[model samples]
Target chain A: MSHMEFTGKTVRDAIAKACEELEVDEALLDVEVLEESARGFLGLVGHRNARVRVRKRDVLKEVLEVERPDSRYTNIKPQEFSEIESFSKSGLEDGKITQEGALSENIDKSEIVSQAKEFLEGILCRIPVEAAVEVSVVNGSIELEITGDRSGLLIGKRGQTLDALQYILNKSINRETPLEEKTEIIVDTEDYRRRKQEILRDMALRMSQKAKKSLMPAALNPMPANERRIIHMILSEDKEVYTKSYGEGPLRRIIVYPRKAMPNKRRRR
Target chain B: MKELVEFIAKSLVDYPDEVNVSEKETEIGLILELNVAQSDLGRIIGKHGRTAKAIRTVLNSASTKRKQKVSLEIIE
Candidate 1:
C-alpha cells in the first residue's frame, strides 16, 4: 500500500498516531519523519506539527529478496555473511544504535541480557516490524527471542535473513566490547531454529541413505551456512557417508558422498 | 539389526534397563529407532558422536551379510 503522511506535535506522537490508524504495532509501521516540530517566539505561537510518512513494511517483498534462487546463500561462515551488503542492508538500514554502556571483560548475565535487549530494541525501532526482544543467557552465549506479528518475515526463506541479522549483531556487539573474549549470540523467533535443526537433521539422514544406495553423491539445495553445518555435524562420524559443501556462493550446496564398498581408502581424522 | 543396536546401546548407556530399540521394516530395508535415559544420552553419543558411528558401522557390516539395508536413529 502507498504510504500516508501523519502529523503530530512530535515524532513519537506522530508514530503513535500512525500505529493507531494502521492497527499495527509501532514496530510494523515504516516511519519517515519529514519535519520536526519547533517551538519559536512565544511558548507555542510558531510551533509546527511534526510530519511523518507511514506505511506497512512489505514483508513479502523483503522475503522474496532474500529467497531468490540466485545469490541466496552466503559464505560458509556466518561472520562472512555480515559483509554481504545487498542482502543485509534492508535489515540493518537506518538502524540507530546507542552506545551508552560499554561492555566489560567480566560482564554478568543480566548485563548481557539488558545490553542485547537494548541493541535489539534499537535495531527494531527502525525496521518495519513490531516485536519484543526477550534476552536470556544459555550456556555462555546470549539468546534472543523476537516475538510479534511480523516476526516470521525475519526468518526469511531458509533463515538466511535471520542468520545474516545474527552475524551482524554479533560482530557489531563484539566490536563495541573492549576485550579479546567474544560472546556468542543466538537469535531465534518462535522456536524456528530448533524446528529447522530437526528438519535438517532428518533430511540429511534420508539423503545420505539415498546417496549410499545409488553410489552417487547426493547434492542438497543451497542452504545457509548454519543449516549446512547441521548436516555436516550430524553425518561427520557416520560409517559409510561423508558430507561436504560443493559449490561457490549462491550456487554453493552440500554433497553427501558415500564411502566406498571396500575399505581401500580409509578416511582418517 | 534390532538386537545388534539393542546390545550396543545397552552396553554404552548407563541405564541399560532404559535402553529401547525398535525395528521397522520399510522399502529402504530396515530402520532401528533407539531410546535411552536422558542422562546417558551423551554417553551413547560420545564425543563427536564416535560411539554411535562405530555402532552403525558394525550394524552396516551385519546388514551387508544379511543382504539388507539398515540405519540407526538415536532418538532424543
Candidate 2:
C-alpha cells in the first residue's frame, strides 16, 4: 500500500504503529500528523487518540506505475514526491522568507525547476489536462511554460487559474530547499501571462492618459490584486497620474488620479 | 466569531469533519486557531494564503460591529 492511517494514544505512538505495521524504519516513511490526542478531566474520564497518516518513500513510484502507464512517472522518484509534499505543507506559511532563504543558500535551481514541473504535472493530471512543461531562465526568474492542448482551460478566466497554479508551484519549490536560499518561479501557459501583462500595461497607459486629460480620477474595472498591481506599477513612474485602490475584498478597483490633484488631497486630509 | 471561522473553513476544506476552529482570548484581542486535515490544508489556505486573508477580512468586518479585536492563525 502507498499510504495507511494509524491511530494511538499520542502522535508518537501512532507513528510507531505505522512504522511497525509497514516493517520499515521511521526514515522510510513520510509522516503526516492528523489529530492531536485529547485528555479529559481527571485524566481518566475521557481521552482521545491521536491520528496520523504515513506513506512509504518508495511506494509512490510503484503506485504511480500501476495506476498510470504514462512515461512521465519514469523520471520522478518516490522519495522526491514525499519530500516535496512534506515541505510544501510546512512551507505554506512565511513563503516569502522561505523562498529567499532557499535561493541565498545556493540550492540547485535545476532540481527546483524539475520538481516544480512534476508538481504542476500532478495538478494537470487531476484536471485530466494534457500538457508538457518547458523550463527556461529569463532575467533570473525560472519560468515553466505549460504547452499542450487544453492550455486555455489552465489559463482560465483573466489568467486567474494560471495564477493559482503558479502560486502552488512556487510554494512547493520553496519548500523543497533550505530556508537560506531564495528562488523565483514564474508559471506561464503558452505565454498567456506575458500577453496579459502587455494588455494590462496598455490599459494602464490609456486610463492614466484619460485621467490626465479629464483632470479627474479614473476608476478602472474591478480586478484581482495581482492584475491591479500591474496597473499600479505601470503608472507609478508617470508624472501625470498615480493609482490608488478602492472598494473591498475581491471587487476592489484601482483609481488613477492625476498628480496635480495630490496636493489638494493632502490639504483636505 | 468562532462559528463564523469554522463555517468558512469547513466550506473550503475537503474534510469538513476534520476542520477545527478554536478561540482563545488574548491581551490584544481574540485569537482564532484553525486546524484542518493534512490533505485539506492547501485548500483552506489557498494560493499564497489569499483565501486565508480573505477569510480574515470577512472576520474583521464581522468583529468590528462588536468593537472587539480579533485575529486568525492557521496552525499547521
DockQ of each: 0.01, 0.01
| Superposition error at A171 for model 2 (Å) | 2.8
The native-contact fraction of candidate 2 is 0.00
Expressed as tens digits, the lDDT of each residue in B1-76 for candidate 1 is 6765675566455688999988889988799899999998886675557566556654654565567888889999
Taking chain A of model 2 alone, its TM-score versus the true chain A equals: 0.54
Residue-by-residue lDDT tens digits, candidate 2, A1-269:
23578899999999999889889999988898878999877788777899888877765334434232223322333323323333333455433343344345453467666766776676555444667888887644688888884536666556656775666555545543444454668888777888899999999999988988877668899886567767766775675665655555566677777755423311112
TM-score of each: 0.43, 0.48
Clashes of 2: 13
Ten residues in sequence with the least summed lDDT for candidate 2 chain A? A66-75
lDDT of each: 0.66, 0.68
Off by over 4 Å in 1: A1-109, A177-180, A262-269, B1-76
What TM-score does each prediction get for chain A alone? 0.53, 0.54
